[model samples]
Target: MSGNVLSIADRQPEDVQRRAVAAVSLQRWREIEHARVVKKGGVPVQTDQGSDLPASLDAWYRSQPVKPGRISPRLTLTDDEKRAYGLPKSARLIALRGLGDEVDHWSVAVFPVMGGYVVGVKAPAGGGGVGVFWRLSHKASDYARRLSVEHGMLIRERYA
Candidate 1:
């Protein structure tokens, strides 16, 4: 978990804010990142309400780091949900709640790679606040143990 809140840091002149990468589209990421910088300072990148940020916030948003494989964790996305929530076209289902047949809903977060914090955002009614955790699961695969241990991810029997 990040001990310091998302603060306005000195962005090097050479640092360019990325519009999109493999995980998200260029046009979409800009709009969402813009809202995030100005609104809740990093929580609720988008909300049930709405976001209409000023021009300067856009720059600040871009200054933040966004890399490949870092994306919103929702495997399914409806057309409307994509636009409404600023979701990417493709996403990974990173949880197995209950029987894991299907997920009802997903909370949004930035899942940083290795030692970085998982900063999450929930609804206002659901209690709005950032939740940060820094450690990775001991049984993790590439980055996270969202599904299960890497060696046993698919075939428990090892028959193949």
Candidate 2:
């Protein structure tokens, strides 16, 4: 998680900020990464969430080092959950921080709106902030729309 968070330090602010809008997306990425690296002795793979590890060697994979508590963990969509949501069997997920690229080093929430088949958007955090970015995919775009409708209202009521 720290590696992902710390990587934020080196990324283009605009990019990170764009992705951070939908905090859930970041959370999802965390979950995916965690699931992939739970063991050791597996083949190295790159997941949409980044760094894919086989189930066997997941426990032993060298985790990406990060500053303690530098950033919160990411949420993930399981294969079954994603399928239930009408998402593709395989879709990419990524999480990024909206620091340096904007004021107060705020973070963003993002994810595949639907099944990452077309487009996606960020759901912004507070004070009329910008949302995160999603790659073009139906799943991602649909999720973005749902986020705008569901979480968007909640966020607006709470933070607005």
Clashes of each: 1, 46
Candidate 2 lDDT, tens digit per residue, 1-160?
A: 3554556546658767666766778899877866676645264434443235322111111232335875533334466434444445564434323311222322223322333232222223422222323456444445555655643332111111
RMSD (CA, angstroms), candidate 1? 19.5
Across 1-160, the per-residue lDDT of candidate 1 in tens digits comes to 6585543433423233242232357657877777876785655444543233312211223333546796323234344344543323442222222211222233333344445333333222332222234454332222223322321232111011
TM-score against native, each model:
0.19, 0.28
Top lDDT hit: 2
Candidate 2 residue spans exceeding 4 A from truth: 1-76, 84-86, 99-140, 154-160
Q: Against the hidden true structure, what lDDT does model 1 obtain?
A: 0.34
Where is model 2 poorest over a 10-residue stretch in terms of lDDT?
Answer: 53-62
